[model samples]
Target chain A: MYPNDGFRELDRQECLRLLAKVPVGRIVHTRQALPAVLPVNFSLEEDGAVVLRTAAASELVRAVDGVVVAFEADEVDAATRSGWSVVVTGPAGVVTDPGEHERLVRTGPRSWVPWPQEVFVRIEPELVTGRALVGGRSLYGVRPPKWIPARR
Target chain B: MYPNDGFRELDRQECLRLLAKVPVGRIVHTRQALPAVLPVNFSLEEDGAVVLRTAAASELVRAVDGVVVAFEADEVDAATRSGWSVVVTGPAGVVTDPGEHERLVRTGPRSWVPWPQEVFVRIEPELVTGRALVGGRSLYGVRPPKWIPARR
Candidate 1:
């Protein structure tokens, strides 16, 4: 459980690890009266960012800009009684730059299921938060883990 | 593969099956210049509807009223060279009635992970749509299956 004072901040590498283990995640963005969330396939980037794919004219692509979007990924190990979740909140937009898109194609966004026709989308995170559940019989309480930022 | 006209509309039972097989899906809503797509967990109700969970104070509760929110679930069977997708688009909103909430609890959502403290949200679908992929050798195209309206 997070302290009421604030959500514990996670370092970049820890966030990356959490992102990698979770197969599915929620993307939250503003719509009319409130925010909306959708699920997408994603991969962790070398810079500790997130990348996913969508159709070229996807509504998700249009929502990018000053909007605050959140991408959350989590994994739970029931037998071990442990789990972790990472949320990357930042600016999102379509990767229109030809050079950047090509580079990403070469080195970023690995997919569990192959779908090469999908267009790639990138998230530049402004805030990264995460929590880990540990202890039980192997039992313990859930709490936010210590975070260290990735070295730039 | 579907014909150029559009993917076939799916039946209610088929939509339920597609929902059960996929672990992730997107909830799409329109905002400003673009539409917002967020990932969410959903399940097929006994009445052949879809149910989800979200924070009571979530924007989703507000945005879903009378608006067209698209809930999509899909999966690909690589070995069989087949895949199928179901999309439920309709009016969505928060469910606060104790009776309704309890009924949903008894039925359970299709979540791989457990979320004991989460709140339940339900979507009354107005339209159900779907498609399927078949064939082993060729990259078959997509086509619409069928469309069904919600029960009055």
Candidate 2:
């Protein structure tokens, strides 16, 4: 039992369950053909769609529309040094239907920033995968080194 | 004052400074032509390299070696609904030099899991970007919905 890797693969149900627990997650998309990470507050839809509202004019809204992107959310406990990370990879679409937009506006994620105009982006979870890091709490924390040389 | 967007852009030095404060970050890479994310505990080297050690046989080690990836870490204070997120984008290279590997062994990240054989992957910070979500603490938390339809 000890030799077994503590990295446990989670099932689809569990992955989505964990996804619903966190309010913030990083959205991974390509900007200028290179990966870019943006931390955004998100809401999980009933159909496993990861929905987030951003400013209408925000660069992310335009860049991610109809594009495949990855969303990740996780929680690591300090005392246990263990947690589960779930990644959802799928295509993102800006919610444009007035009816659907109204539904989301009434029961969607609270805005982290107030913007003049905002739009909803929904990411369909086409591929879901996650791992649980468990049973390693021996190391308390790394001592803060007095200094780290400026990398310039 | 409130007219300004709550998200204030951070400069390079400040971005690295925030990156150094967190031990855990998510590494975004491509798997099967689709983006994937993994939470890793990393250390900052003097040369601004983000280093993380993982099992030698891990798929990520092979998938990310010499490939461009994105690394992000952030801190959120539930108190003020404010925090900073920093992302570093660059190419990842596995430590092949014996001397460098040993050097990392002496002062690298403490493993959250006990892996028998681990390899260190170093990522250069080519493009560093970050933002501060400042001043929005009114809403305490989101209440959980009583039910959600399972997506099948």
Please report the candidate that would top lDDT against the real structure.
Answer: 2
Question: By DockQ, who's the top model here?
Answer: 2
* lDDT score at residue B39, model 1, on the 0-100 scale: 48
**Residue-by-residue lDDT tens digits, candidate 1, A20-79:** 775556565654444445445576776756777654544566564446677766554434
State TM-scores per candidate. Answer: 0.55, 0.83
lDDT of 2 by residue, B1-152 (tens): 00123446688888889989877888888877888777778899876789988777777777789999988888875446678888888999989999999988999976655465777899998877777665534332332111111111
Look at candidate 1 and tell me the lDDT of residue A110: 48
Candidate lDDT scores, in order, read 0.55, 0.74
Q: Which whole-number lDDT from 0 to 100 does residue B88 have in model 1?
A: 72
Task: Write model 2 residue lDDT over A1-152, tens digit each, in one string.
Answer: 00124456688889999999877888888888888787778899877889988777767776789999998888875455577878888999989999999999989987654455878899999888776765434332322111111111
True-vs-predicted CA distance for residue A59, candidate 2, Å: 0.7
